[model samples]
Target chain A: MQELMGLYTKKEVYKRFDEMNLMELLTNSLKVQMKHIHIENNQTLLSVNDNKKVYFILKGIVAAQKDDELLYFRGKNHFIGLESILFNEESELTMTSIGRVEVIEFSKAEIVEFLMGLQEGWLYCYLISKDLNHLLVRNYFNFQAKPYERSKIMLNDLAKEFGESSDEHVLLPKKFTLAILTNYLGISYVTMRKILETLRNENFIVRSDKQKEICIHTKLF
Target chain B: MQELMGLYTKKEVYKRFDEMNLMELLTNSLKVQMKHIHIENNQTLLSVNDNKKVYFILKGIVAAQKDDELLYFRGKNHFIGLESILFNEESELTMTSIGRVEVIEFSKAEIVEFLMGLQEGWLYCYLISKDLNHLLVRNYFNFQAKPYERSKIMLNDLAKEFGESSDEHVLLPKKFTLAILTNYLGISYVTMRKILETLRNENFIVRSDKQKEICIHTKLF
Candidate 1:
């Protein structure tokens, strides 16, 4: 895998609004009808066919899955169920809290009205759309890869999206478990364990003490 | 595949602007600098990493490819290279005309300015974004499917998007040749031929008389 081609969805253009002080805009928009939601560990945030609301993550991680297959993970500043609003369709992925998750929630109508009030609001929708497009492109190539390469690509994406990087390695958050990895790869627990075991023996990955979090070696990318 | 779950990206919400008379609005926005471009069959419309303009297809079809891999196809009313405008990144796919194609083109700057001028313009961007989001969701599941299932889903999607349906069959446009189908499956020519032969024997698919087009039996979906 190419380091520069690492699947980091956010680009410089996505952060363009930061210079314009998005916090102020978000603060103003907060006056609209919205809710502060707190979900317990393992709680469901959104389910397939639910399309009434959107949630912007404030803290902790959320895992998105379709049926039993894990699709991906999202963290702080990511919007959950935005696809419901964008496509005006039922939520395709079932999102759940990995740990305790905090989010600011908005009804579809409220958010749509708020977005209509701003000239640059389309840019926000455009940015989220770009994120999905990037994933599509990544997965397009990923599906064609062999098992080891597919596992490596998924881990590399996770490391880039949610890991804390150091000179030697990238440390994934504690909430990312082996079970979640297995789910993402859509393989049996035993099969995924063997794959991980092989990768570990080769020094491509390391699990921290207590097996809570995984450390991905930088050279894997 | 469930008939309702047939991968049609456009929904009732996407058609909302149609009732609002988008043509008049587009005509009004036509004052902005735009070009009418016509390209012959097999001509390149947008190359990978060249991101400057957006094209709205007025006639014929386009095939989007990443390197040598076929990503998907787009037809009339679809916009090409919009990802460049949305993400402000270099184009990821090389778009080529499948046949003699006509499109209305806009520079990145002009379209941005035009979209900013209307309050409802964000909805336009939102709709296009929704189209992409739909494709992402579709591809997410598609990547995990087996080869035959993947091929069926692609044909079903193409049937719905660009085909003319009768009571018994969905006739795809002439531009969708065997080569394109083979490219889409990412299989060797021999393998794709075998798959087609099997599907044909099973009465799931039928090639047109001239073999320039394909007809999908409605029962396949």
Candidate 2:
């Protein structure tokens, strides 16, 4: 995967195959195929134990969960259903759409056949890039930290990445709900709520009704 | 990387290149090289900020650290120094040998050039397999669990995976030092020590002098 990085970006790798018009050439000669799928917001794309299907996300965010627990989220350019494909086991996590999601769906047999047809090494590059991206995000948090410390770090990161900033404060977007934010921090809802309450008491954060938007006080930091 | 899984194991992928005698064919014709190195235990293989070099572990374990904190351990068949190669940034973690180690070292330029010569997808498959293996081990623990709960779960998992079992107890290997075990659990040393003390007092675990090997009392579970 590291070697692939010095060669091409994931998108570029995918395009190299398309640019060759290998799709038309292969489909006409070989029988490899992919299907386009459109999923609505909150729709479950794949449930636990689902197998042999891999979704290449073209648009929108996908939430991965283990039963009731939210594991993480993947957005554009990420592939869902990899666990089942990689481990040759049942899907351990269920994946659902955050908004409307469009994907190119490939069955296990078709993907293997497609790679065989290419023999060009680009598909392998694309897969490694996707896995590297997944690892980067999952490795961002310090799992050893206490809940309060973890929450603070997560909030600071969110503010820097997604918040709208001014001199006094940075406003977190409405999309990052309490559930999503808390889960992303790998903390319980109650713990995160208490942490947020403490931050508010300390004049560090200002929250809107229903806790949709949060204003992180910058001066305090 | 998930896609690569249904294709070949990392070792199998590597062997595909060698078995083809592509090395002799290419080195004689195109000029590419890989170096083999032996590292002694506790010796630093790569320091923070070192770039462009990747190590393919042929034997023994390598410990990755961020300063004094143990980040994770990678053993045989894993690649060390991928972060620098993938991100095009300085290495974030320092890698050191845990035991006498053997590795095939490849410079970034040499590796990329070699892959280009092969025109085969096996190298890409190998890279993805490595990343997938890394992600699997890192994702094993529930980061949100309390330290006590986390330690218990980790201990149970360790016993199942690496411990020597008897009717009454399970003995953790001598290689699992307090530092290594606590760090792998992603808990503070003090917290892990306190947890162990409680377990011992409750007759759930027995420890030898200097805490070399821990015997988990099976009947308690």
Candidate 3:
């Protein structure tokens, strides 16, 4: 521990760890112990049966797929690889970086060991539970929502995670095109465009600029 | 523990601890710790926000609902109250007895302490994960499938869970009516009847009797 601390302290690193989205779930000690890793764009960060590592995204996007099926379009602030780690089974899912990404890695053994420290470490369980709730509920809504409903749900999800609240409306985090929105909803671009047209007509959403930022006007679901 | 064991020894009051569902996931000591309860028809077995007990169904059917939405129509050999207990959050979903139901219940604290034992108790996590996977995937399939596809997917689900295998064909566990099938898939009975007619014409499924024991003629999916 001393050697690692010394190695990090020589202007190489120090205790003022940068605040991270998902890492806030960890205690300060656990925070410093987590190792950082970078994955290149389009790289296969984790593949089928490679379950030794578990991490949380600190920046950028990663897509989780099982065979040809897309499981999640995971992004920063999400606990990636959590499902597999919880069970100790080698993952059958493949995770690939959509772009250059940063993540904080934790060894599978260390995580289990930490979780096992039960009463003293119950927060870990709560943190994992929180992630499970979000991921599973989002997936459920995806299964239940119609194209128009899906558009609203996805927009709300994006806004909740990345957007800014204003006096009149909530603004989207970034410019999103028909293609991107359609992909998120697992629908066709034409259908998504039509849905957006309907939403605009109904005043559920409005395009903020040429850059495509969206302002949500009404709760559709 | 000894007193409880003696109390049960006067009569043979247990299954041979058969190779049934949730029991396989429990440690032996925990298995002995479970207490049995019977729920009457139309009874509220576990209401929303009641997170005190976790149970495994031994017989009969239970319906889990979140207000007007049906979450699951659970039958025997399934663990109930799993999600809430894993998160230690009170369940918002209400579980009601569809018929006379038998269950083996365990105290929440005991289960958590048992799980805190780790390695030996990790099976509980796996059990929970398997359930989560089933539910999330089912919800996803629900979102993706059309009425016809949803019907087929649901039938496949029933067959996988309750069907009996024979060389000639797979036999459904129970005689299900068009109403029941339609309700499970969230479609109209008329549409479901039409789907069944088409299935019979295509030889994908054949009804065994007026009671409606469906036989799978081919790989439907």
Candidate 4:
């Protein structure tokens, strides 16, 4: 993590920061107001602080959510709390560091002011404006199918994202516990288990010990 | 909708158009590229023409997303396809004009150019950059609850937003059919119905004709 920090100026907010100038302005704004923070592995990112400000991950990994029905993982160059700041509401997500980590924190007031001012980082302001507008629009879609189709699509997405090619099939990343999968998909554990079991029986997924992760071979939908 | 348009200018992106120079630059770029497009109510915003681009709504209403659990409504000043444009992915949501609508449309190439050439519209370019960063960060931590709790919270949110103020507690808006509610909550119709029935029996909600809509007299959760 320290090595990664040494690789560049602290003003670079993301790996692709140079890909666009708007990104540079955004990081610069955050840099001007940011408070450096650190947390131990498995510690809640907000464990010590309860003020609900946004944090930018300068280094290390974090896992967030169990509310949307699955655990989502994030790492370097990512940020937290735009939703709350954009909407003027509290963040609906909680985060825990995957390891010892470093971050730059910003008060909600500062971030909003930065956007409201729309001066130096106005480009970023436009994007987030577009994003919040999109988010409000997206909240209406992403789940129009029957649970069967919905869960199947999610499985496919997961497979593409986290599945590794193996001799027999694709192996899922280790952390997808049945509890997390069921919750993320918004299905009861029993129901999701039964669904997966049926898929296994049909040879869409490989039957294996529940203690281990899942591997998939075919479309279960 | 026309009344709402009369309340604002064509250049204001959010209510804060005049707030920053970057917003001005961002809007200027879009303004130069924007083509005035109109669609009648229920008309396809993109059902026929399939090139995906971000559109800023200037008048009337539109509802986007066909595959998600519920219908999302957008009105004048709202925009669509930002998620797709920013992420460089196909928009999974479908859209239709709600009544009659007018929009400012910009092609993907133009928007991308606008973002990349930050030296020109540095302000807008900056805003989108920040928004994407915020979005990537936000995806990690929006949920941290059991599925049951999460769904209930969504219900409370719906009631709070759409429910009307009547003497008999707040009545839900007319649009929340069980179909919409069940889909929005991502619960099976039978399960959601049973859950609501149980709430009714417990006096958290009033028994009502399922044919029309649902109303709540107490905390439904």
RMSD after Cα superposition, model 1: 7.2
C-alpha positional error of residue B42 in candidate 2 after TM-score superposition, expressed in Å: 4.0
Q: Comparing candidate 3 with candidate 4, which one achieves the higher TM-score?
A: 3
Name the weakest run of 10 consecutive residues (lDDT summed) in model 3 chain A: A10-19
Q: Write the per-residue lDDT of candidate 2 for residues A1-221, one digit (tens) a residue.
A: 34555588746755554423443443365465678889888888788555677777777678766645565566666566654333334555678887688887767556545555554534443444445444443343355566777677667766765578899899876657787877767777888888998887777787557555679988755
**lDDT string, candidate 2, B1-221, tens digits:** 33444587746645654423433443364455678899887888888556567777777778766655565566666566644333434555678887688987767556555555554534443444445444543343355566787677668766755578899899876667787877767777888889998888877787657565689988755
Candidate 1 DockQ, CA atoms: 0.26
What lDDT is reached at residue A49 by model 1? 59
In model 2, the Cα lDDT at residue B48 comes to: 58
> On TM-score, who's better, 1 or 2?
1
Model number with the top lDDT: 1
Displacement of residue B96 (Cα, Å) in model 1 is: 2.0
Backbone clash pairs for candidate 2 read A1-B127
State the displacement of the C-alpha of residue B49, model 4, in Å, after optimal TM-score superposition.
4.3
TM-score of chain A of each: 0.81, 0.62, 0.67, 0.57
Candidate 3 per-residue lDDT over residues A154-195, each given as its tens digit: 777766665567766777645344544555576787787687
- The digit string of per-residue lDDT tens for model 1 on A1-221 reads 01211333436445654313433465576556667879899988788656677778888888877766677777887777655454456667788889899988777656655664564555566566667677767776666566677887887888888889999899877777777776676556787777777777878887556544578898666
lDDT of 1 by residue, B1-221 (tens): 01212344546435654413443465567557667889899988888655677777888889877766777778887777655544346767789988799988767656655665664555666566666666766766776666677777887898888888898899888777777877776666787777777777778787556545578887666
In model 1, residue pairs whose N, Cα or C atoms come closer than 3 Å (at least 3 residues apart or on different chains), thus clashing, are: none
If you assessed candidate 2 against the hidden native complex, which CAPRI class would it receive? acceptable
